[model samples]
Target chain A: MVSTQARNALAALAATAGMAAFVAGCGTTSDGSDSASSGSGGCKAVSIAYLGAKTGDSANLGLNMVGGVKVAIDDYNKAHPDCKVTEKDFDSQGDPEKATPLATQIINDSSIVGVVGPGFSGESDATGKAFSEAGLVTISASATNPALTTNGWKTFHRVLGNDDTQAPADAKYITDTLKAKKVFVVDDASDYGKGLATGVKKSLGSLVGGTDEIQQKQTDFGPTVTKIKASGADTVFYGGYYAEAGLIAKQLRAAGYKGYFVSGDGSLDPGFVKAAGSTGAEDARLSCPCGPASADFTTKYKADNNGKEPGTYSAEAYDAAKVLLDGIAAGKTTRPDELAFVNSYDQPGLTKQIKFTPTGEVTDAVVYAYTVKDGKIGDATVIK
Target chain B: MQFFFDHFFELTITGLALGSIYALVALGYTMVYGVLQLINFAHSEVFMYGTFAVIWVFTAFGAGGHTSTGGIIGLLIVSVFAAMLVSGGIALLIERVAYRPLLKRNSPKLVALISAIGASFALSETMGLRDRITGFVGLDKPLADYVNGARDNSSLPVEITPKAVFKIGDYSVTTIDLLVIITALVMMVFLDRFVRRSRAGRGMRAVAQNPEAAALMGVNAVRVRQITFLLGGMMAGVAATLYMIRIGTTRFDAGFILGVKAFTAAVMGGIGNLRGALLGGLVLGVAENWGSAIIGTQWKDVVAFILLVVILLFRPTGLLGESLGRARA
Candidate 1:
């Protein structure tokens, strides 16, 4: 396991070139959790930590969250350079096993007052209890497994709806919008994928033709495709991230399924279209709980990051990070105070209106249905 | 059970295609093992580089778009040659850098094994971190298309999507299946002829049987070893090209699992035997697909190894006895 202090010191030095004083200050506060210099509107080098996949198979998805967090940090730093908070990356690689040890190391750091993400569902489930026990605030931008909230982690909060909200809406879109009579459900057998598939299966009770489970990195979908084609399903609904989902979509089209393909938020990125090919991805419906990005925010985000478009939950991540930054700006520099401030956070964000249930579920969610046209996932229109 | 029987033919054909990839890649493992009596773990990186060569050559040709059949054929020939060149070069370099030093030092076989594993990691990271490497040399922007997405999947979507050529029962059979299987067979036949009838093949066999004796007989043991690695690398190049055509995407780490499967195929076929690789690959592929169809698609990964275990239990020397030294010459 990587020591958080070492990673942070190295990153701080490389990123700033002159954070020796801040590094020394953080060292002094490493123990006795309450050792940080507090009680002022201006913070003393307290930072926001990003816990997500910086590298791995789902890295493309996790990177969008990193982009959002980066934007928030830039905005905050620009507004107040006097108290510039650093952002350290703890790359969990979206694997629960990797995330658990990283989570332990993260809680041991006194400088990281809040966390922006534990991106995927499984990683969130693995790291949530540690953050809660340490009284550290964590707001996930994308993890949608519904069972997450049932764990009773007080510091846990989400900017997007759970799988229960998104999956039912996705099923409705598949049935009403596409008018599909038979739907074959497939999951990557992940916590997020299985949970979402269960909801879709329940909602599309009679319409489901068959269901199958696929492994995460297993590329050959030949047997599953054979089964789906044999079942005579009109539409194939995949519950997985873009990495696998896009390949599944491509293989299905190649096998002459010739039916509509549907997926949830996990497949909403440009990578999906690239994976499925321009023509293969045409007319594929993607249901996401992420509200449409405001034009101003989109333009700003693009300019901020090499003209690359925001991915599925980038907007929600931007909002989640801003919420934590706002808490710090308002004098909540410690973990407990930051948690309290986020617990009562209620404001309109770039993505949606932010308010949470007592159980940490977002008060309401609006799912948007997006379709691929000419190899591009077009702008979203409200579906639920 | 009924689904397995009904779709068995379809599963078998596609399985054969997937197995062809394993067979071609397995030849690399079996050949190197035959010559050096060392598992060339870094051979997977040789395969991966060849896939990138295919992608890069195509990307540079017509900006990755060609509609006409002639254009596609021209692209295919040029890309395959490019893949073979790149893969063959990397294989030679690995021989020089990773294995040759250890061999010269008369190091323990375990030390050479560690060197091969280290070479595997080094080669994998070099490809994975290509963007940074190119950037460090101030060529990132100039070489954006190649170096970009250093770690993510480099998807090469089919421009001319393959059409179904025929129907086997209810399943539509496509050209990709035929192309992959036929290519593997051609390469295998060519390799077999080269190993059996050619002078260099005779030298290789002599070296494998007894390197010191072959050296005394003026066989040039080092040259024979180099030829073995070169042949294996070219075969890996063929496998890489087929994989790109069928899978339509490649990542830095793409070779790991496929390499494991191919190695398993080689072991199942008796590690040093040539023909055994093809047989083991086809069997494993068909068994896994059938296993998925019966138990569930989720069990597909374990099915191959489980079958291997069962087969190994019965035939420890593998389906065919291990023999490159004892080939019926």
Candidate 2:
């Protein structure tokens, strides 16, 4: 065994070494981020970047998206071994505070020809301006806010439907189809949620009886539900993810608001059913881009994913990666520069023949609506 | 006004529940700080480890995914016990490995602080690095099938997917929320009593106040410090299990931001005081929820940090003073 004196000396050395390492760590002033935004390679392979919450609250969805992209890249790499597609991943964690800097970092990367996502609408909104100005193409799978379409980001593309298509579809079904006049609209109050809610409310102007704006991550929806119940609203449309939406639906049903409950694509998940439970969420109608468990993609997705549950945007993520590869194929970029190469990405792909207008929205798109029946999402119905 | 009241009740309950989790974590921070007077910056990693520990044990014992009332009591006992042991061991190791040498050399507070921060970073990085290995080993479980069942019966309404709702007049409480809140409160009360009434607790307070005096009084200050670390570790483990039940899953790096929130709660509650940590956690949780209600969800973290700054600027002593029974630890 080592003597006490030797142990003491080793401890002193470790303490000194740790202090030195910390001092080096705090020396981040030298712009010493190890995630070198720009690699030295000048296009041996096409680089597509993804910026989203790979490691935060929305990490679950982020992981699914990354998986879809990785799958796409694997497929693409196999198809054309010569035209290899490389990918760079960054985790903004759904925070706009980090999104701006991440955008700059991604933009600085000389190899990245296009971007698959910035995930949440807030992060997209924050990064869109800079990305557009820098002439980078960004396609989002999950971001459904209407604001993103009109934000004047020419380089942006959405693989799936946006709130513009989704909100009105929801309003039409809930108000006109479901034959409900008295309605309460609740938003998660994020850019996506509030925007979607606003879109639905605008469409259902006379039909919407009342509205409530609840912030995302608020665990209890009792007050919002109570207000809806008191308003005599026969239906409620929540514009948020499953976390808050599940709890809200549970409380509304439990509080005896037996009316219809519907939410935008954000609330599309088995987690909602699990969290809200069966009784409260029995008749709940959840609107999403018709892809979760539908026969079209779910059959293949389930097989490929090893029976893993398809999250809300997994299909869209798959489509986003496909579009990026398509863009690379369309250009036939043996060694084309990123800035020049990505500009020509406004073309057709396997998913939906993606072509972005000056505003960066797909020229033509449709929204899919699904109802949460017994906690499992039913076959999605497309609204053309 | 009706809307205000309608929103108030739910927001308050949510805040209290979320805050309790924060409080559990904050207790660890305060306890560690009390003995060492050096921030246990890595306490969040301990919380994260505890979360994984619960997940690991549940998966191993074949009792994974959504704790039922029947299985919950047993799961809680095992998970809590396992987490406490793991966290306690981790905390002691961290102290012995990272902090003990600095104390022996009488290193500058700045040096110790830097070392603590490094240790925190190291732990966080290690947790994230574990993901790479775990992914390779293919531990990815299809949670939907086991957790959510099937979707075939479109017309038939199965019990709400997680059909365990506890109704209290207007409130529709779930078993998950109820357990989270009760466990947090019970833990806090127990810790308060132990620190206030027990001989060991008194010894801890003495050590916190003046290590030299406690040493002179034959307190075995080193052992006391280790015990406090153990307590902090145990508390972190409990907090992690509660957190997972709320969020439904645990990731490798889940504890970093949570640890920050817990630390903020501890500081908000007044760093050395146990009750302050408790109150601070509740306040932060409520404030974040209410802030989300008023502002937007995007600004939730912003609001939380702003509240911390305002609290620090206005009343550094927090909601409670800087002590459990006596003054500043």
Worst 10 residues of 2 chain B by lDDT: B149-158
What TM-score do all the candidates reach, one by one?
0.84, 0.65
lDDT of 1: 0.82
Docking class of 1: medium
lDDT of 1 by residue, B1-329 (tens): 88888888889898889998998999889888888899999988999999999889877774443347777767778888899999899899899999998898899999999999999999999999899899999999999988898877887634547678888887678988988999999999999889999999989888888999988999987788889999999999989998888877788988898889999999898787888887888887788788889999988878889989988999997888677767742
Highest DockQ: give the candidate number: 1
- For residues A1-384, write the lDDT of model 1, one tens digit per residue: 111222332232222212332364355455323423543443476788888776554666677888888888889989986677777777766667666776776788778899988876777888899888999999999877778899989988999877678878988888888899999999988766787888899999999999999987677889998999889999989888777888888888888879999998777778788778887788898888887677877787888888987776789889999999999999898999999999898998887788888878788677888889888888687875
Tell me the spans in candidate 2 whose CA falls farther than 4 Å from its real position.
Answer: A1-163, A206-234, A242-259, A269-284, A289-364, B2-16, B64-68, B135-182, B197-199, B243-270, B279-316, B324-329
Displacement of the residue A62 alpha carbon in candidate 2, Å? 10
